[model samples]
Target: MSTATQSSGTGTGTGTATADAADLAPVRTESLAAILVAGERPPRPNALQASLTFGWRAILKIKHVPEQLFDVTAFPIMMVLMYTYLFGGALAGSPEEYIQYLLPGILVMSVVMITMYTGVSVNIDIAKGVFDRFRSLPIWRPSTLVGYLLGDALRYTIASVVMLAVGLIMGFRPAGGVQGVVAGVVLLIVFSFAFSWVWTMFGLLLRTEKSVMGMSMMILFPLTFLSDIFVRPETMPGWLQAFVNNNPVTHLASAVRGLMDGSWPTTEIAWSLGWAGVLVAVFGPITMRLYNRK
Candidate 1:
């Protein structure tokens, strides 16, 4: 019995010692590498792919926090209703007649106003340090900024569509038919996209979201309100008319209004396109520089 017990104890001790020796063995670089990367690494995403990825991320954020859509939906609905009824009778003698003139302008105003939120989003992301991780990635740099604009473009579209629905309900008819209406909306969205770059630059330059918002409102209020949206620039004082006439918003509003009315205002369209190009050319570089430094 003693001999059998001794043998059993010896076997157990040897097995335990062997297990520990294996555990303490140094891991080889090859083995470690194999374990760390189980397969071939993925290729770095190209600019378009990267940009689209970030854009999708923005959309996902909206999906998770759907309340972000309130500005696009509720605010637009309110603006259309309040302005159509409030100004309709006073401005054009009747609500129905006024809607025909007001809807396109209102559409431009609402979408342009919401473009400021792109800067707000950039500021928020910077605050949360989300951008830090983005910087460390191997993707295209401008993709992040472009992604925000693309996502906000969707919001612009939503606001435009909602406002149009409300306008139609309010008796705003576009003489340009569906084709003209579509063209007008497309032009507005393009301008809004270009305009968003301004806000993006502000977002990079400003330390806080509120600061960006305040600056945007200060600039936008004058541009939108002083233009031919609510009243004709000809009715304003001479000096004020000069500013209103040159305002990019005025050109955008005029272009959109003309398109929707089937008038095809070539001068307005050219001016609007020129302004859009100028915005992207000027602000886009500044924004990218700020983004890289920030």
Candidate 2:
């Protein structure tokens, strides 16, 4: 008899073969159907741990591309040195006096400027298709941005230290003792962290890394130079002075200068913190929304 006909019989070998085929058919069909229907869900990660993992990943990226740090390390030092020597005499009577006054302002400006890089980096990652991989992973959705912010904190710290060290070498002194310097540093880090959310939002909205960088400079220049970073706002036209007086950068600089000078900075500190809160409240949700949509 033919093998096909034999396999269909109820006798010993044929019975076993028929039974095996029956068992295997359903399994194969079900498995294929399951695959076509839906994939198994990946396990979710703990929110905090996932975010830190992302943060560590960002830190590791710098090892492979150390030039990523040029802005945080080199530019701030250049700004402190060049501005002190070039504009010190013209703006603050002498470079010596300007070093003291301008150092605090430069410190603030440097950290704030560094915030732009956060946006550029975010945009680059999105453009490179890395964010799509992140989306496919089972981690918390916001963890990627949170981790990036954490990594950028390291950048902010390095920039702050570089600015302070360069200032001291150039004869800048803080009248506020150790306690005051610490407070100023804490405030600077906090403000920079919050300001980063603004850039993060811009990164999500913009199409290209170059556009993000260009727009960031456009926004930051008015906020920094138009305020009191290099010169007294009062020296400007009255209309300009009015805007400077209300500028958030003005409050941040005033707060930093006050802390370093051992002066009470109740109003400035309050305003600085308020601006930080406002930036977080407004931009943070928008960034997350755009990220989810993208």
Candidate 3:
């Protein structure tokens, strides 16, 4: 009897210790089903999160699609030579004059053109239901959209440098030196960023990637070619000239050339940036509105 009592008491003590440990362990108040359901809620991105995520995605996409390098690395170089040597004499007085005037315009157009493809990628994701999957992530809702915006910045910078290198190779030196060149690039990039918001809205609004790409051509081509990319607006017809004169792209390109050639036009620069600011004011809200609805 005494032996049995001692054994029973030991078993009781062990059971009590085990119960205490169970009570002290971290508790998950929510069930697995509840946690899983919570994950289905859409993520909302903030500004910082959007930038970082976009930057990462942009870089990774670069890794997977090395073909993108052709655009930034090769196309601009060929374009510079094509416009400066082949078409220069026909369009302008001489190659040197054409190079000086055409450099800034081409640079601005390149960045703008590269960014217009954002809608294609976005619409592709939307069509594939990737965005809906994002909506299910617990991530910040704004992050997905904001990240896309930041991701494109890397390509913009790369494209800018490639074009500048090509221009340098062609004997087109900026009179204002490095600082002027940097300022010119900065102005164009700001303009590109402002322009991207409008495209981004299209991405959210469109149905298929192809449709968005087609619409992109409609918007991008008119904005770029109709500007003073190759020929001066003065050579254009009176009514057509009015439209070119008022074009924001023309003002931005002119300001870039002015800065680079040491013919800094403060009024043009201010007006160009004013245009960028105005675009931001108008489209930024529209993008957010569409993003939320998505």
Candidate 4:
């Protein structure tokens, strides 16, 4: 079950969106449908095409609900205020100082939260016979399943940009300049889309949308708190520090922090991207499995 990979590169910094071709060597049989008519077989539909169909439908669904825009717009402001004025003095130095540190974390946090909504919406559609309609269509094995996630990546982009704008308005500035800020937000949305594959898998397997919401959150809660999302991981116990050190969210947060500070690091980006690839590898197939079951 493969979806499209997008590449983004700037003048000096060129990032290729190359899938590990070796990984695509064989696909799971469940990622296909078996059809026989008088000992004849049907040619398989391309998964990318199916995924894009899901993407287009999700975009259309978003248009129907104008309130979808409010999530990212309101969520960031509330989180910034709750974390800054409420806990800034105790956690960091001051509200202003903490925001300087907090903005990047919140940027990624917004992406994380936005992905939850994706799971919710997907589960809702699944429960309400949307997937039934989709199943009747000759869609790709994982395209509709994976494309739903890709569509939400656009929402993640909006959520990240909206939060960044709100942070700036509240005196949260990225010292890393415009390009750094762009890179930080881009990686965050990409990472969120990758992590969202976990939620997508759960949503595909779960029966109820509400259960999907709870279970999806149960999985992410530890990932959010145990990482460097709200507080410094260095402050954790030595045993926990090892976990935090290895957390992809921590690497993502640290990389964003580096970009915001206009500092360069060679390794954190790899750690973050590696985590994204891992999530996609593990959960992408699971989503395909559940999607086929439907």
Pick the TM-score winner. Answer: 1
Candidate 2 or 1, higher TM-score:
1
TM-score of 4: 0.80
State in Å the error of residue 137, model 2.
Answer: 2.3
Candidate 2, residue 26: Cα displacement in angstroms equals: 16
Residue-wise C-alpha lDDT for candidate 2, range 103-145, written one tens digit per residue:
8899999899888888888999999999999999888899999
Please tell me which model should have the higher lDDT, number 2 or number 4: 2
Candidate 1 lDDT by residue in tens digits, 207-261? 9999999999999999899999988787889999999999999999999999999
| Per-prediction backbone clash count | 0, 0, 12, 1
Q: TM per model?
A: 0.93, 0.84, 0.81, 0.80
Q: What's the TM for model 3?
A: 0.81
lDDT of candidates 1 onward, in order: 0.93, 0.90, 0.83, 0.78
**1-294 per-residue lDDT for model 3 (tens digits):** 999999999999999999999998875767756777877655566557656976698679888998967877787787788889887788877898689888888998888887876667777778888888877776667677667767777788899998888888787879989889989888888888788888888998988877788888898899899998878898999999999999988999889988898878998899899998998899888977887788
User: Which of 3 and 4 is the better model by lDDT?
Assistant: 3
lDDT of candidate 4 over 67-166, digit per residue (tens): 8878877877788788888878888768888888888887776678668777778788877887787777766656776778878888888877777777
CA shift of 236, model 4, Å: 2.3
Q: Which sections of candidate 3 miss by over 4 Å?
A: 1-46
Candidates 2 and 3 compared by lDDT, better number? 2
